[model samples]
Target: MDVPAGVLGRLRGICLGLPEAYEEVAWVGVRWRVRTRTFAHVLTVEGGRPAAFARAAGTEGPCTILTFRSEGPELDVLRRSGPPFFGPPWGPEVVGMVLGPNIDWNEVAELITESFCARAPMTLTRQVERPPG
Candidate 1:
């Protein structure tokens, strides 16, 4: 699929200073990055098979949207606020399903960037975290 480059470019501008890679993931194109110590990716899954169209937020971190699919109300709000960020309109439930703690656009970008900055070299990192204590 011809994923939009504008979206990926926007993400690149948002998180500079990281090495980015564009590759075919899950049958779709994804942009991934690594910052010497961390990795991050971002993409969109369209059609039946969940394709990945990601933009790397950082090096050494899991990409955005891919990691924000399993959270809670925080994601619900994001789903409701779709468009420009999410692209197209989906019902509350559809939005919730696609955009969550590990799969939404905004949270995905933020999470990927943070994880890339914090992850240690060669250490397996947990992409998502529980609500702050």
Candidate 2:
């Protein structure tokens, strides 16, 4: 299944809003990156094509998955949330979120921002105006 246009548009806005962030077509899907480091990636997982992602999402059917960098308490919280949230088979800091109806766009934006910060250099990350926790 293709990723919804609205969801991609929203992700584009959030990621491109960051300093020095750029979007590109990744091997399987689209990814937003800071320099050479990928901060966020969105792709369709189906038929266990990408076995790791399929296993991570716990599904063989089609699903839109967004993977991003996250850490600390926020990462821990998401990992415990289940379903829409899961641990992608990547680095320690990588988190996978299943996109669908009833998604919290505000939360998605925040997570993308955090993902940017995680991958961006201090020079660029300093430019982001993150909300108070």
Candidate 3:
């Protein structure tokens, strides 16, 4: 379950707005942020189980923390067996599919980068509010 360094670098470069962390071994995690706010986190490697969490911006607050499965079928079984976590409406769910088994690491990295960009706040421009009379 080891991803190449070059792949990781490309992903990070695309997400310069956020900080991405890879290769934490058993507890490897990737955190996506906007300026200083956290938008999402992916637990790439875990010794105990397979799970992940994502956070969306412009919401009431931090989401309830939806759980996602990695490696396809394994995650499916985990969900069916009454796991502590559940899936969230983070994406089309095709991400894990493209990454795992399919061996499409490049596509996976690109998808992740796109997701981060969509989640991250606009680095330019500001919300214009009209002055109350």
Candidate 4:
């Protein structure tokens, strides 16, 4: 319960707000999916990042990693944002953001929404506001 429920709840709402969205626990945390395809994954590791990820990250675990779907230019922007956002292990098309009290829920929601849109089918994607360009 160290992490704020508000933060988690906000993320949950944004993800599940999408069409056919659902939640499942895995990788020691919860992941939101559209049908069977995961768009956002949240995990708080108590012992630094997992070994596999640490290699690429060059950092230990004990961090909250929230990975989401992102494409080239947009993905580049997130990775460049620094601190809270970074590249996840072995994923060219995804980004992982560190979660904490200082995190911006609005920005988080936008990222998760885009992630959902990217993974969800056209029929489902059409349901959301489509955010901004």
Candidate 5:
């Protein structure tokens, strides 16, 4: 299904709030990047691709999900948390969660920030963590 405008809008607000974050669409989905490194993206489970994730994220049809660059343990926590959140088909260090009404916006924002910090360069990370006086 079409990604709700509000869902993407809110996510954009959160991710782009970080240092040097930008958005782009590619083969995978809408990726939020720090320079050239992707810290997060949306997942679209197209037919015949990502079979396992399509089943897990309930995206067998047209659906959009917010995926993040995170650690394996964190992904496992999200997997156990249930609906609107799960691990992607590939990448043990990646986590994805369906963007839907059930999600708490604040939590999503926090997750996005954490994901950005995880992938952003140390230079940018330091700036975000400690702005110039």
Candidate 6:
């Protein structure tokens, strides 16, 4: 199964909107990168092809997975959120989210923005307008 067009489109809008961010075909799916650093990646998992991701998602069936960067309190929160959220077995700061009809696009936008900032250089990150905390 492939990533749904609407979900991919929404991700494109969020990820590409970042300063100097670019999209490319990843090993299994699509990834958005800032320079050489990938900040966001979306792919479909099926038949436990990617063992780690399949296990983390707790399913062998087809499912869309989005992996992105996170840190500090946010990372901790997402890691403990369970279900739709899981800690991908890669970078310590990398977080994986399961995409479905119930996903909150606004939250995905926010997470993608944060991931961009984490991977982008200071000069580029400074140009992004983030919500006041």
Q: Report the C-alpha lDDT of model 6 over 61-128, residue by residue, as the tens digit.
A: 58899999998899999988997998876778999999977998988988999989988999998999
lDDT of each candidate versus the true structure: 0.38, 0.88, 0.37, 0.77, 0.74, 0.89
RMSD of 4: 2.3
Residue 35 displacement in candidate 6 (angstroms): 0.4
**Which is superior by TM-score, 3 or 6?**
6
Candidate that would win on TM-score: 6
Ten contiguous residues with the weakest lDDT in model 6: 49-58
lDDT of 2: 0.88
Ranking by lDDT, best first? 6, 2, 4, 5, 1, 3
Model 1 error, position 8 (Å): 0.8
Ranking of all candidate structures by their TM-score, best first: 6, 2, 4, 5, 1, 3
* Model 6 lDDT, full chain set: 0.89
Each candidate structure's count of clashing pairs: 25, 0, 0, 5, 2, 0
Evaluated with lDDT, which candidate comes out highest? Answer: 6
What ranges in model 1 sit over 4 Å off?
18-27, 35-38, 51-109, 120-133
lDDT, candidate 3, at 103 = 41
Q: What TM-score, computed on C-alpha atoms, does each candidate reach? A: 0.38, 0.93, 0.35, 0.85, 0.78, 0.95
lDDT of 4 at 4: 46
